[model samples]
Target: MINMSILKSLGLSINPKLHVTVLTGAGISIESGVPIFRGKGSMWEIPEARRLAMRASPPWNNKETWEFYEWRRKLVSQCKPNAAHYTLVEMENYFENFCLITQNVDGLHIKAGSKRVLELHGNMWKGRCMKCGKIIDLPETPLKTLPPCCECGYPLRPHVVQFGEPIDNKILIEALKASKEAELFLVIGTSGVVSPASQMPILALENGAKVIEINPNPTVLTPYMSLSIRGKAAETLPKLWKSFFTD
Candidate 1:
């Protein structure tokens, strides 16, 4: 059960009228069997694989790059959205203005039916044309070509923002705006390391939002949160979601 004491100790007053913004990270999907990039079984743990995931090395159209993304597509396709993802969807319905900002490219939040999601890392289920700059939704089934081309006959790249690349300016600006406007900011399951994304909760704090962190352990962001609830988000989030009701 969620510690009801959190209400008193943290001095948090939950109401339906507040604007809630949630930020999630790879830790939320670990239960769904998504391989985190820094973990032991990660697809990017391989030396050559790391090169393909970063903008510092091979070009997006390289054979190795395409092979890596193909394998990644298969792996991600097999995973499903977890309870935490579903809770976010429910939370969205509970509040009038809710926005989900995620560092994961897995598309689990979208899979769980979250309508107002902003993926800071782009998405694995989409591909961008290298030449034509067109964005297309990629299917889970194997593509006929290794370097899938656009209708314009140009090679496609994974839509994710790779290391050494900037987050899309438009998306970043919107996320920041959401953070600043949030009455309550929920920081869930993130390690508090990744850039720009890591900066979001701070912006929330600066703008007078009550930041609540739900993670199994303390992170760089833990101390700043108005309350830090120690637990897995899959378990903790559902309880928090239920508490929004008066019943």
Candidate 2:
């Protein structure tokens, strides 16, 4: 069962004067109908995205990967931001200094009206030029055929960092900066088990940020958090925000 007393205390403790940095993961979007890629019975792991992503080999770069990703794009393209997303937006609006760093590539937070967002994993709405370093914008929905670059003729790939790929330095630097400067770090939906992303919460904690974790299940970083609200973000965030600040 969820503890409302803890939630009340957390709300009371928040200092609106301090900067708030939120790090989000795929779990938040699961309620919006996107697949949770890493959790139990995840179908994405069956094909092992890491192998293909490492070299951009067959299946990763081939027609199959394109078809598969197109299906994923179709699903993501149809999804809309849920209550949790709106709650974050409201939080940002209320706070003078607020930063959101998300691990998911679905682009829901941006769609939900977050002004300052650092996509730790690059967005799926964009395409990358394989031949050149240039980025190409693509339709949010899947294209009928492989997309071509404007400057170069090579096939454009999803802008996201697939398994085995490194996170973009620019995004990483921004996240690090936010983590270092944040006085209140909120980790939502993430299990804190996924590599470098998991490390950000710890870095924020080390930098003297008060950490608050929101997840249905206990996570590796739970011990370090100032409060842990065990529930879905969609249900919990809005309640927390509404209880403190009225519309």
Candidate 3:
């Protein structure tokens, strides 16, 4: 359990007028059974999977890429938002100024009823035509082949950012601006290794926001956290929300 004193400190930090920014990652979605793709002993550590998500020239041509994504889509289709996701949604209702920025492409945050969301990574359930750039909502039914565009007759790819592709500049700028303006910042379930997502906590700190980090393990950003709650978000968030709202 996280120290009670830390929770008390966080409660003291909250102000009715302050804007709250929540940064989320794969760990927050793990209760819904989503997998984390990074760090030691992870699935993406496999050379083939890494090559598939990383190397240039359409890794989908490789059976491993196709099979992996197919399985991933299936898993995503079955998963639902867990308690931690809803806790953020509840926070949105209580906090007049709130921004939810997520590294997850699972779409769980939106499904959990978060009204304002900034998806740092693009979504997986949507695809775009390679040739004409038309967005297509992926069918709930899985497809054996890459889905083709109705308009341009070209193959479609997941809207997500692949390993080598750069993040959209407009989204990055918005996330940065949000972090800077927030008076309360929460980093939820992320390992804090991914760049830019990792940069947000520091941005918040420099701008005088109190930083609260909730993760099961110690992370690279642990030392900088004003309050570090050590637990899975599914368990911790509901508890923390209880402390703030029902205590």
Candidate 4:
């Protein structure tokens, strides 16, 4: 269990006035049965999968790409939001300024009832037209076509920041702004290695925000965190919230 005294010393509490920003990754969703693509047991680590993902882009192997994401979307749809997701929803309601920045495209945060989420990567539940750039929400079931088409007769790609693709500038700007203004930053279940997203915590720290890391393993940012709580987010976050606030 994390020592509450440590949190108190850092000036983080159940105060409604505090501005809290949370950054999440695949780890948070793992307990809910989501498979991560980078770490051990990652599907992407498999050579064929890696090759497919690498070439899974429009104007390339669009069929394989769409099939891959379609499979993922179906898999994610079968999972439910876990305790950690609910804990975040509670935090959002308790704080005046709460921003959630997630690298996950699963859309679980929204399903968990968090309102102020900034998706660094686009959502899997949505698609963007390759030709006209129109974004649309995907249905729960897989599409009948390999690459679904937009009204303009152009193929619609998964609304995600594909490998080698740059993150949307507007989303990046908002994340940076939130990090800079945060009083407390929570790093949850991320690898802490990916660039840009990895820099969010650094921005928060530079701006004088106290950071708390919640992960079962040590990450690159662990050494710099104000307090490190070693546990799965589903098990750790609820206890942390209960320690701070009780209804």
* Cα error of candidate 4 at position 186, Å: 0.1
- Model 2 TM: 0.85
Best by lDDT: 4
For residues 1-247, could you state the per-residue lDDT of candidate 2 as single tens digits? 4434443465434446768899999889998988767657554565654443343443243555565566667778888999999999989988888999999988899899998999888877777766686777666455757543446677777778877888999889989989988887889999898888899889988998778888989999999898788989999878766655432
lDDT of 4: 0.86
RMSD of each: 2.6, 3.6, 3.2, 2.3
| Candidate 4 structure quality by residue, lDDT tens digits, 170-202 | 999999999999998999999799989999999
After superposition, the stretches of candidate 4 with alpha carbons farther than 4 Å from their true spots are 3-6, 45-55
lDDT of the candidates, in the order given:
0.83, 0.78, 0.79, 0.86
- Local distance difference test, candidate 1: 0.83
Model 1: per-residue Cα lDDT over 76-195, one tens digit each: 889999899999998888788899999999899999999989999899888888788899888764777767778898878878887788998999999999999997899998988888
For each candidate, give its TM-score against the true structure: 0.90, 0.85, 0.84, 0.91
Which regions of candidate 1 are displaced past 4 Å? Answer: 5-15, 39-41, 44-57
Q: What are the per-residue Cα lDDT tens digits for candidate 3 across 10-89? A: 65544466788999998998778876677665657667666655542463334444455666777678888999999999
- After TM-score superposition, the amount by which residue 55's alpha carbon in candidate 3 deviates from its true location, in angstroms, is 9.7
